[model samples]
Target: MATARDNILKKIKQALVTKVPVPFSTHTETADLFQPSQKELEIEFAEHFTNLQGRFSFCSNQQELTEQLSQLFSSRKWERIYCIDEQIKDSLILNGMNINPYNDLAGCDASITGCELLVARTGSIFLSNTTSSGRTTSVYAPVHICIAKTSQLVYSLEQALLQLTNKYGNHLPSMLSLATGPSRTADIEKTLVVGVHGPKEVYCFLIDE
Candidate 1:
């Protein structure tokens, strides 16, 4: 006797095998969907990121990046910054910053993280579980500081996804996320609220590589 679950599975399998024709289909399936970007990837990304209320800065070298971060730290007076990447933590510590490389997300003033790729058109930071600064480190902190290289910048999400696939041929990260800007919601009374579910402030430091 066929049960309801079995019948449902059978129907689903049949649907999966059945090919449905589109009522309105374009024969040019391989054509590009969006117009070409007019400006440089970095410039476009910076503009879009700033428009989304995300702070963007460019650093010429590691020394410049350190100097810029130190200045920002003094300005903001961030005492408890959480960073888990050993390389970044070491660099920060060597430059006289007190960066702890342990799991301390609950009481961090800010978090510094590394991204997998950056989407220029969307001004989004693409992250994956493969990095030491995983999903939670980027999302949970009140302030998120993402360090990205100019080489990681791509024109669109599709390009980023393609790069990611090429970078990790057969094995992709278990999880992937895009941080377009700071957390925001307008669920209650239609009033826009930022930092409701995630970081209130987002800063991206683009290093020329």
Candidate 2:
């Protein structure tokens, strides 16, 4: 009288057995994975970032940054620069350089913005919606320029995330982006391409102050 389904169910039930649950603990201690000194982090980040084809520069103060900017602008001949950060704006103004307000990304030669943190392990820059330029500014322009202070550097990605969590708490930004270098792709015929989806050139102005 037992159907195939009934027989299968009975066989499955016969294989079942109750066992005591293993005791579990929520906490576990582990050795630190990243504990590099500040100088080490700076060196590693610069090396990695340069390997990824990113331009890196270190400045000691606002005056040094201004000088660097002047040299860079003169060499690159960037005429239509778009900047959103107030500090960068003021710096440019003080340098007697003209800055264009955000209008269309197509019209800008470069875009300058500030980042939340720089990851030493990966040579990545983290940005969030809370940044002055928001999410699109970095990708929209032909060239992306980041202004980061040395104190904002973290040894690893985990530390960077912890810093963000502590700073934002429950009110975290809507999005967090970590950019390692200029955008690149190799989708067509296995040929490598750069800057298809984002900036072709990425420059970081690292301030020691």
The local lDDT score (0 to 100) that residue 30 gets in candidate 2 is 47
Candidate that scores best on lDDT: 1
Kindly report which residue pairs in candidate 1 clash with one another: none
The models' CA-based lDDT, in order, is: 0.86, 0.84
Segments in model 2 whose C-alpha atoms lie over 4 Å from true places: 1-29, 34-39, 95-102
Best by TM-score: 1
What does the lDDT read for residue 187 in candidate 1?
Answer: 100
The C-alpha local distance difference test score for the whole of candidate 2 amounts to 0.84
lDDT by residue (146-197, candidate 1, tens digit) is 9888999998887788798899988999889989899999999999999999
| Model 2 per-residue lDDT tens digits across residues 1-209 | 99999999997887775454656432224444767765776788898898999999988887788888878888989877888678779876787766656667678988888999999888999998677377788988999999988899888887888799999999999989998999999999999898999999999999886
The true-versus-predicted C-alpha distance at residue 68 of model 2, in Å, is 0.9
Model 1 regions more than 4 Å off: 1-31, 94-102
lDDT of model 1, residue 59: 90
Per-residue lDDT, model 1, residue 198, is 94
Q: Candidate 2: how many backbone clashes?
A: 0
